[model samples]
Target: MKRVTSLLILVTMYFSIACQPTLEETNSQLREEVIAVHDEVMPMMGKLKSFEKQAQEKIAKLEQEENVDEARVEELKALAFDLNKAYDGMFVWMRQYEVEDGDKSPEEVESYLKEQLVLVSKVNEDITAALEKAERVIGA
Candidate 1:
């Protein structure tokens, strides 16, 4: 019975040590992660712009072609609009965001960074979806 209890206590202590993150570590990791997400998505804005231009050129060429499908052209236009919106959303968010610093407590900074991670994740999702839709449209 004594051996079993000792083993159990050892295991619990090991797990607890492994599972816990210090507040500073959490803050730093979350901040780096959120910035990485933003960096990953930032280049997509320029790609979106390029896609928009290509789409416009394609639409123009289609218009010159006889028997063009107006509905298809309209769909491309809508996709372009959405892509622009996604790009703008990310740019605006970056412009508006401020870094948490020494003025804030570690807990407050961690909380702020965690919130930013969610926001940046959402922006990344939006940009990815927009890029995928634009690619499909361009391919079609």
Candidate 2:
């Protein structure tokens, strides 16, 4: 009976160890997820650029004319700033991001990847929110 129990315990331990993912695997998966989020929002760059141009044009028009709605001009200025901010955020993230698999330990790599995931996710949110607001502002 004791032998059978020991065998069962060994089998469970073996399976558990075998099924667990390595840190490298975890980091790779995290890297893929981060890139996926970035990719999802990347196409919005062109839209952001277009909206920035439109907003600038509108602001310029409003500024040149007398009795122009100051509030509308201000709103467009803010939106244009946010659009550029989001656009720059993505570029900043891409520029600073690095894959450290050689000098860093697997655990360190995983941690770095996790941090990157959060950063990219925030960038995605910023881009998404800015784009949505821009669309509404322009469409209205």
Candidate 3:
């Protein structure tokens, strides 16, 4: 009876250890989270271009007039630039991003995922802010 109990305990411990998530698994989860954040913001890309176009069209119309509101035109110009910049940031990040483990160590993979999360978060913020600014200027 004693021997059987010990064997059972050893088997249980082994299974428990084996069932735990490895560092690579944890890193894979982190990578998924990074991709999730990216996916959440990607659909807004078209709005960036649309808002930029509106800003440009407004600027053009204002520029053709003799009594142009320079302040408003400048604001629109800045907004347009911001929108385009945010749009470009997404593509740049995507181009630079890599998910393949390659020959990287687990620690290195974790570090890379953490860095990518931060970068994508910043890009997400830029996108949100630019879109909000556009909506405000374009009247909802």
Candidate 4:
């Protein structure tokens, strides 16, 4: 009888502890979601930067050459269309995730600002890379 009672107590304690949520688990989940959004959107931002640089280069080439490259302009415009579509799609998912996560609270907002700042920094590096490529392509 004593052994049965002890076993029951042990099982109850194990179940209770297993059901409890840990701070680490919650944080890891949040981090996973944030990383997923970053992964989803960062590439789109890079594509935008690439399109912007390509458009700038085409504009410069059209300016410098005696005859404008209508084909390059059309190509750039097509890239712009694709870039806009990608940005819109990525942003829709991002906003939905943010809303569902309820990250609009002051503290959450502050955290988001910090994370976004880091993301912006990374994107700026990508933009710079695109700009360098554009400069090389345009001989400028």
lDDT of each model, Cα atoms only?
Answer: 0.87, 0.92, 0.96, 0.58
Q: Model 3, 6-120: lDDT tens per residue?
A: 9999999999999999998999899999999999999999999999999999999999999999999999999999999999999999999996978999999999999999999
Q: What TM-score would you give candidate 2 relative to the actual structure?
A: 0.95
Q: lDDT (0-100) at residue 99 of candidate 2?
A: 55
Model 4 TM-score on a 0 to 1 scale:
0.38
Write the number of the candidate with greater lDDT, choosing between 2 and 4: 2
Lowest summed lDDT window (length 10), candidate 4: 96-105
User: Alpha carbon lDDT of residue 135, candidate 4?
Assistant: 47
The sequence of per-residue lDDT tens digits that candidate 2 reaches over residues 1-108 is 999999999999999999999877888899899889989999989999999999999999999998999999999999999999999999999999995567998888
Global Cα lDDT for candidate 4: 0.58
The reply for model 3, stretches above 4 Å from the true place, is: 1-20
Query: TM-scores of all models?
Result: 0.77, 0.95, 0.86, 0.38
lDDT of 1: 0.87
Task: Tell me the spans in candidate 1 whose CA falls farther than 4 Å from its real position.
Answer: 1-19, 63-68, 100-102
lDDT of 1 by residue, 1-140 (tens): 99999999999999999989988988889889999999898877889898888888878888998899999889978888888888888987898677747699998888888888898899999899988998888862
Pick by TM-score: which candidate is best? Answer: 2
Q: Is candidate 3 or candidate 4 better by TM-score?
A: 3
